[model samples]
Target: MTRVRHWPTLAVLAVALALPHFTRGTQTEFAIEVMITGMFALSLNILIGRLGLISFGHGLFLGVGAYLAGFMLRHLSENLFLLLAAALIVGMLVSALVGAMVLRLGGVGFVMITIAFCQLFYVLVLSTQTWSGGINGIPSIPRPKLWRGTDLPAWLSLDSEFTFYYVALVGLVLLVYGLKRLDASPLGSVFSGIRQNAARMRALGYPVRRFQLIGFVMAGSLAAVAGALHASLFGLVDPSLLFWTTSGEVILMVILGGVGVLYGPLVGAALFLALFHYLGTLTDHWRLVLGIVFVVVVLYAPNGLVPLVTNALGRWRGAKPSARGAAVALPEDAT
Candidate 1:
């Protein structure tokens, strides 16, 4: 029974693992992009779904990680792990500072303040041409080295799309597994409590705001990791990452996938990207089609596609009893 409950996710993971074997290398870029985007969306989910905080500038941290990583790779170190550590540290610091400043504001105020902070960084980057490369962004961004040693390992190289795709894919898997475990942890219970009733949590002596900050910092830091992956994937760090629209896209992904569900954002990112990829070639006004689809999903399937599909399938199956149950129907009579 426990296995039955988990089989869907396991099935999806199996498909993900087997994808590269079945698909062409050309599809590797798309797979990597989906994994990265899914990570970003899920990170934001920690805020919107669990913490009940809607940030409009989550991408600010992403930009920070990307630009910092690009700068480090070009001028300092090529070690990927080192760059990731740097990104994580910088993201935590920046998110903590920003969270401290804006977390006091609730509802719309928090959203507005976040936008302001992101804009500030955006303009700051745009103004510093030598530092951030201004509006043009940091070009020729180098890929990080897997190791800092003289001889490279037998099994690591970011230059190969095949290798990097699996790297990011494995990362996504681990993230989902960790988050699933976290969902069952005491901290997750606290987060769920806070989401349900912040005032009640405060009455119980839980530092609600502090928890929110922790969640914010955690989300932002994870987002920065996603940004680093994005930079590595494209070999460029751009101003578009910090743009408000980028945050909006993640919001869309969460909505499309289903907020509050761990794997929802991933499914959402995949679906959203599918639309963007397929709809894009069909017409220049692809966004219009995408918007319509989004609206349809929101109106008809408010819980997002995952739950909707799952429940619908459950109902269809439930409507028909299995023959095995009938074969054992001595049930009430036997008792």
Candidate 2:
């Protein structure tokens, strides 16, 4: 019965999954960016929303995954699966090591430290001009060959914008659903509890640090997936992946969507990217407009657009609209 009730949602997802194929050029590129950024936001949510950790160094995972993908494509196999696995493993290890150190800090200090770490990575990319091409960045990254170099179907060609869009859509859906399942599991309960009250959980004998580190690693792994896809989709990767603004964008995305809700970031990403795509066409000051919108969302709906809208709709639906004179009151004196 519950499954039956969810059919509408599933139908919506199906339509979204198919919608990108009909578009071409910039529209398709925008759709793919939305999907990939949505995944990145979700990965951030795992840390900020579920585990109560705000990592400003998340670009490390993203940049690393992209560079790793580029390196693998150049030197090793172009098999997408192999590249993704390698990227994820590297990302997890990077996060685990960083988490072990940063998890001990709290508040603004931690944020500063993470930001510093991200800057460190960015500088390294710039310094390795021979390997990473410095500011020029890697370009013309090849798309993965289908079926180990066999002839590809029209639908499976990464060279086709539509094919890549659908691939990213499917990947986002799968990852989002997987995150939802994880959120419902016992481990998720512990993570949530830790988010709400880390001290209380510590008092109750939970290994708080361990749980946090694991959550960090999970988030990093997912972010790496997004990063790898993004690199393949763009057919390029650059130091911009390690930029502080990149991390800031992901943070804004999670905040704009209600964090901890599996689908919220997806919605937020779509809206955000749509604005960047369309509004950027109108003026050179699109960043100003975006900044204003973000400020409004933060001030008025800190829990995010999805939660605010859903709560309003729920209230409206649950309320019984009173007809004229529907309510009567007796005087207290009469009682």
User: How many clashes in each candidate?
Assistant: 0, 0
Off by over 4 Å in 1: 149-155, 319-335
TM-score of 2: 0.91
Per-model TM-score, in order, reads 0.92, 0.91
lDDT (CA) for every model shown?
0.83, 0.79
Q: Identify the candidate with maximal TM-score.
A: 1
lDDT of 1 by residue, 1-335 (tens): 99997797789889988887776765878999999999999899888877778889998988998998889988998787888888889999999999999898887788888898888899999999988999999989877768776577645658777778788998788788878887799998888788777878889999988998989999999899889889988889999899888888898998887877777899899988988898888988989988998999889987777767766776688854322111101111100
Over 4 Å off, model 2? 319-335
* TM-score quality measure for candidate 1: 0.92
Indicate the residue-level lDDT of 245 in model 1: 84
lDDT tens digits by residue: candidate 2, 45-151: 88877777777888888998888888787778777778778988988888888878877776677777889889998999999999898998888888765447667
